[model samples]
Target: MLDYHIHTTLCGHASGSMEEYIEFALTQPLREIGFSDHLPMIKWAHPEYAMPFEKLLEYVQRVLALRQTYPQLPIKLGIEADYYSPAEEAATRSLLAQHPFDYVYGSVHFVEDWAIDDPHNLDQWERVGVDTVYELYFAQLQKAARSGLFDIVTHTDLPKKFGHRPTKDFSALIETTIRSYKDAGMVVEINTSGLRKPVKEMYPAIEILKLLKKYEIPLVFGSDAHAPDQVGRDFAQARQMAQACGFTEIAVFEQRKIVDTYPL
Candidate 1:
């Protein structure tokens, strides 16, 4: 199996060297792995949330060197780029074109200036209202999928990270969100990190998974690991969850495109 959403020390919030994360993956039953540390903050510069602008080359160099260090393992180069407003699309694309990224994960951690997933911003929920936060969060996600700036969409339905649920019915919004992914030929990551969060569930929850299976959008497994031991953190349950949702294969990407797929 493969775990594609691993992070590196370059992203200030994550710990461990790139080598440590890879070494731990080797100990698991993993055949392939990828480093998708948070891309440098664009339109905003937050040192604690992502790597600094100057470290982009450093991040790329380190991951490429690992291929030479461990020729036996298939290590992929990737980045988890946050999805900002549509106005910032051009700037984001210009930054992403600087390197040969195997895959780019389009993620939505912020709704406006406040990060919905950050513990420090928990009070923002009260200010913005939980229901409105959910609506705005999914809207930003739909825009990200349609922008065609990324290969895989990471951690769909992320507002529930702190156990806050929407008071309104968002079935139509959810279906439309998945449709944006389908229309753009995007892959959705079945992120296992949610299980570690207070929600105690996977990202894109079971209901979203069924829609993914129904819509025939491809799948990829991600631990969204911040440290070494988090690699393949909950595969036994994640794979079982995927099979139950009718997913038989997971995608493998290269140079920002899917090269092939691995059986689930």
Candidate 2:
């Protein structure tokens, strides 16, 4: 198994060092592990959300050192970047170009200015209405896919973070997003963090996964770990889900490209 969405303490909200995660992976049955810490944001500097811009080089150096030390393990350096709008896309691209990441996980954690995924503002879910929030979330996600900035799209249905379901059918929106992802040659990550969150399920829900399978979009697995122990957590379940979704192969990346795959 390969888990590509790991995080380290440099992201502020996570714990442990990059070496600790690699050490933990060495004990697991993982074929590859990637450290995709939150990319430093020029617009959002909240330490809890990502690493400070000044620590960017330090983060890269640390990961590179670990890759050298753990040659036996296929450790990849990656980043989880947020997509806001077209205006910010150029800056985000420039920041990404500064590093040679194995893969970039694009995600939308905010809609406009509201941090919809933050537990501190869970009340916003109700304020925005489930229908409106899902629309905004998918719209931003489509834009992210079209931006050609990410190797994998992380947490496809994160707007349901609070377990609030849209009152109306969103099949069209979901299909459009999946089609856009396929059109852009992006992979989708079945992130397991949702299982540990209020949603209590894997991201990109079963229905969404079915659509991904229908479109033949390559799938990947991410534990979305914030700590050492969470590395590869619930990956067996994620694999089972992928198999059930009709995916026979899962993707692994190197230098921002899917260089190999593992059976589901």
Candidate 3:
């Protein structure tokens, strides 16, 4: 198995060193793990959410150094980039070009200037209304898929992080977004971190996973770990979830492309 959404302390919010994360992965059943710490913030910046733009090169070099230190395990250098909007997509593209990232996760943590996933921005949910929040979220997700700036989409239904459910059916929006992802040749990651959140379920929920399976979109796994101890956390459930979704394989990435796949 591959738990490819690990984060380090440099991301500002996460704790522990990069080596500590790698050491923890060594004890897991994972054949490979990726250090996908949050990339530098842009547009409406969140200093506490992501690493500083100046640490960009340092983060890459640190991951490269770990590959040498832990040659027995394949540790891929990855980044979790935020897709704020299409207007800021060019900045993201330029940032990605600076490194030879194994896989780039395009996630939408913000809708407009409000950080939907942030605890500080929780009130925005009520102000913007639940249905609109979900609607705007899927809109941005569709745009992210069409922007051609990411290899995989992480935490597809992140608006539910605080357990906020929509009143209306979003099947059409979600299906359209899934089609955009398929058309863009993108992979969708079943992030396990959502189980730790108030939602008490994996990202995208089972319904979205079924839609991905229906659209024949590829699947990948991510723990979205913020600390070293959280590496490969709850992977048994993740595997079961993938199996239930009819995903027989999990995609593996290299140099921003799916080079191969492994059993789910």
Candidate 4:
């Protein structure tokens, strides 16, 4: 098993230290583990959602230091960066250029400057209606995949995690967006985090997995873990799900490149 998306205390919302998460993963049968805590925002606008730039550097330094002690473990340093507008993206890239990360998972955690976790938007189904939200969400995802700074696209159908059923049009939009990512040589992550929330299905659902197979696009696995216990969470079932959808191998990244594959 390979878990590519993970978080630690530096992110504010997540708990546990980097050493704790690595120690827990050492007990599992995982081949690789990556710590991809949320990236720092340029304006420090969302302190509750991500770590600040100064702390982020400190966190990276701490993780890099571990390379000496855990030489046998293939620990990767990475980031899960949220996409905003073009200006924000440029600033984010400028900030990221200062450090070295094994991979970057492009994610859209907001829509028009609003976080998905906003209490007012929690009732997205009742507000925007499921169909409209799904359509808009995938459109943003298409924009995110084309951002050109990320190694993998995280949770392609993330809006579906809020208990919304995508309409036919919405699904088609997702297929088109994913195809674009494939053309760009970026992988999609089957994030298992949704399973821990109210949304029982994986991020993209089984149909999306089949579409990935059809498009011959590579797939990767991420626990999207917020704590130590969540590392490699539900990876067994996720691998089975991907295999059933005809995926023989799941991709992994290092130094912002696809470096390995794990067989299902």
lDDT for 92 in candidate 3 is: 88
lDDT (tens digit, per residue) of candidate 1 on 185-208: 999999999999999999989999
* Tens digits of lDDT, candidate 4, 1-264: 788888988888888878888888888779888888889876446777888777988878877898777987888888988877666778878877778998888888777556664556676457666677666666777777777878888877777665766655656677788787887788889899889877787887898889888988888889998888888998888988988988899787877888778776
Better of 1 and 3 by lDDT: 1
Q: For model 3, how does the per-residue alpha-carbon lDDT over 1-264 read when each residue is reduced to its tens digit?
A: 999899988888998888888889889999999989899987856779999989989999989998999999999999999888777889889989989999999999888688898888877887999999999999999999899999999999999999999999898989999999999999999899999999889897899999999988998889999988888999899889879889899899999888999988
lDDT of each: 0.92, 0.90, 0.90, 0.80
TM-score of 4: 0.93
TM-score of each: 0.99, 0.98, 0.98, 0.93
- Residue-wise lDDT of candidate 2 within 138-179, one digit each (tens)? 999999999999989999999887788998999998999999
lDDT of 3 at 175: 93
Q: Rank order by TM-score, top first?
A: 1, 3, 2, 4
Per-prediction tally of clashes: 0, 0, 0, 2
- Score candidate 1 by lDDT: 0.92
Model number with the top lDDT:
1
Scanning candidate 1 in windows of ten residues, the lowest lDDT window is 9-18
